[model samples]
Structures are given as structure tokens and as C-alpha cells.
Target: MRKLIVTEFISVDGIAEVERLPGVTWNDEMQRFKEDELADSGAMLLGRTTYEIFAGSWPKETGDFADRFNALPKYVASTSLKALDWKPAELLKAHCRKRSGN
Candidate 1:
């Protein structure tokens, strides 16, 4: 089975809001963390906001961070998006659920 990894940027206070993180202090660490999250992931699970932010910036950049991010298959969760202009991405269809009866 494939796995979905979610990597997020957070503040020193542990907030994952992009607007909350500023400056270049954690740039290296964030890139490293992103790489690590994608290391074993066959694909990624993301919300539309995350996808837009990533697709808008990473694909235009040249670096290790861009390489890994551009390569991974992304499954974005949304219904409003008509289509994606980016490669290596698609709409999420279904998700596995955990059962208590098992």
C-alpha cells in the first residue's frame, strides 16, 4: 500500500500557519523537514491551500528542495478546483478508514 505524508511549516511556538512563519531563521530546517517527510512517501496528501502554495513556488525554483517536491505525486483534497496546471498531481478520490471492529 502507498502512504500519504503531510509536512507542514510551523512557528517556534508550534503553529503550522504559513502566515505565522517569517524570516529565514528556519529555512534550512524546514527544507530538511520537508525532505525527510517525503523520503519514504510514495505520495503526498494535502489540502488545496498547501498545494497552491507549493506549486506556485517550488516548481519555479532550482534546488534539492524543488527537486524532491516536484517529483513526488501529490493527492490534493478539494472539490472546488476545476483543474491543476501542475504535473505530478491529481485530485484525491478516497481515503482509508480505521475500523474499531477489527
Candidate 2:
């Protein structure tokens, strides 16, 4: 079985809203860590907002990281989105329980 690893950035006060956090910046070490993580990941599973954000940005970026991101299969879990424009992307069914046999 494949491992499902979830990574996130949160503040010391347990705030997970990365965009709203102040004084947040990216550095070479962080970039390297992200690059390595992406390289090792087989596919990406994203929510609606994150999928939209990444789809809008990564397509325009050019580099190993962007290339890897664009090339990997993307599975989006969204209830409102009817379709996906990003290549190799699929919109998961709203009822995951059926698929999971839960």
C-alpha cells in the first residue's frame, strides 16, 4: 500500500491559515524541502481552493518543480466544481464513502 502523507504549514498558535499569517516567507531551505517532497510524491490530492490556486500558478511557472507538479496526476475533491481543466486531473465523486466502502 502507498503511504498518504499530509503536509501543512501552521503557526505556533495552531493557525493553519498560511495565507493569512504575517511575516511568512519562503527561503532556500524551504524551497528545497518542498522540491524534494514533490519529487518523492506520486500524485497530489487537493481540495477545491488549493486546486484552483495551484492550477492558476503552476501552469505559468517553468522549472523542475513546476514541471514535476504539472506532470503529476491530480485528484481534486470538490463538491461544486463540475469539471477540471488541468491536464491529468480528475474531480472525485462527492460521495467518497461508496468508493472507500466505508
The numbered model that scores best in TM-score is 2
**TM-score (C-alpha, index-matched) for candidate 1:** 0.70
In model 2, which range of ten residues has the least summed lDDT? 93-102
lDDT of 2 by residue, 36-96 (tens): 8987899999988889877877799998778888999999988788888887998885644
What C-alpha root-mean-square deviation, in Å, does candidate 1 show against the real structure? 5.3
What stretches of model 2 exceed 4 Å from their correct place?
Answer: 21-23, 97-102
Using all chains and alpha carbons, the TM-scores for the candidates as numbered come to 0.70, 0.81
lDDT of 1 by residue, 5-76 (tens): 445556577767776555536567766776777676676677778888877877898877668768877778
Question: lDDT for every model?
Answer: 0.70, 0.83
Which window of 10 residues has the lowest lDDT sum in candidate 1?
91-100
Deviation in angstroms for 39 in model 2?
1.6
